[model samples]
Target chain A: NAGVTQTPKFRILKIGQSMTLQCTQDMNHNYMYWYRQDPGMGLKLIYYSVGAGITDKGEVPNGYNVSRSTTEDFPLRLELAAPSQTSVYFCASSTGQGYNEQFFGPGTRLTVL
Target chain B: AQSVAQPEDQVNVAEGNPLTVKCTYSVSGNPYLFWYVQYPNRGLQFLLKYITGDNLVKGSYGFEAEFNKSQTSFHLKKPSALVSDSALYFCAVYYGQNFVFGPGTRLSVLP
Candidate 1:
């Protein structure tokens, strides 16, 4: 069902460059999230949206921004990529109720040089 | 605030042996615990979870986790380990419209 999909599986960007990580889900879920995984650091939430037109900051949202224009899509924007932003980015979605088990994407691996 | 911890950085076990990955969490409300496995270069895959009903929750791949409310621990366990079971394991707690994940534990099942 392609529960969740993320684009640009791998990308290399120089410091100060800007880019967007695209995420989409076909599960009709209302809750979407962005997270970055670093070695030994587990997953850190970047941004999240409860539904279309609603976005909120997460634990580590300083260098990133997110928007949810439609129920199926939530895109993260890096206005000024920095070396500190280098990590594997994952997009996840959930049903937004009850237990709220999330389904994740394959992840977009970005290297900020 | 809610927090989760996986005390062990890594765990090793012989194939067919019982294996356990430790995790503990802190939260003011009822804890919704979860376990996810990630293979090399892959995304975290849901393994099991504990909500409200039962303390012993069974999940995919013959894995289960016991939620100990008194200890604030939800440790993942499997009766028999397999080489394929070797991966990175994460423990998470659902709270306040967000999920907090642990630092993760690496599991190595030797044949």
Candidate 2:
């Protein structure tokens, strides 16, 4: 399996600019997640999807939105980019919750100027 | 709410020496803990997890973690450290369908 894959390995956006970070997993996982990693900080959950067409906000979901149209794809949308949103974004997928292991993507490094 | 904690911001160890990275968790019920490693400029990778069963759980790259129910801690350890073992380690706890990660601890294995 290809595990999880993310697009646009790196991106630079201006203030108020909008963009979408695409993520796909071939493992046929039922749960998908979006997280951000800042310097000197641990990964923070932004949004997650339990299954297709079912999404929920996570701990740090204020500046982001997500949609899971298919079991394999979960995309995160940034309506208005800000400097605070500049961080490395990771997409992960898991078969289920609790003890299930999460497979992570390579991550997209975003820089908002 | 469930949460994890890594007290140290950084840990230093010499090559071939035993290394330990501390992690403590707070949960109301059965604690599901996990350890992940992040290399420089890369994404986080799963190292190991503790759902239940044995207190000692072995994982990738000769790493293992001990779950101490008494202390609510799950500490990652390696018998012999290597230069390549240097990276960032994170401890996490799953609760309410979400996993909360602690502030990462940076490990530097000196050669």
Write down the C-alpha DockQ for each prediction.
0.69, 0.78
The positional error of residue A47 in candidate 2, measured at the CA in angstroms, is: 0.6
Candidate 1, A1-113: lDDT as tens digits: 87899999999999999999999999999999999999889899999898999999989999898888999999999999999999999999989852678899999999999
Show the lowest summed lDDT stretch of 10 residues, model 2 chain B: B37-46
Every candidate's CA RMSD? 1.0, 1.0
Best by DockQ: 2
User: What are the per-residue Cα lDDT tens digits for candidate 1 across B1-111?
Assistant: 788999999999999999999999989879788999999887889998888898999999999999999999999999999999999999999887777999999999999
In the range B5-111, model 2's lDDT, one tens digit per residue, is: 89999999999999999999889888789999988777789999988899999999999999999899999999999999999999999877888999999999998
Which tens-of-lDDT digit does each residue in A1-113 have in candidate 2? 88899999999999999999999999999999999998767889999999999999989999898999899999999999999999999999999875798889999999999
- Against the true structure, what is each candidate's TM-score? 0.97, 0.97
Q: Share of real interface contacts recovered by each model?
A: 0.57, 0.74
Candidate 1 chain A — worst ten consecutive residues by lDDT sum? A93-102
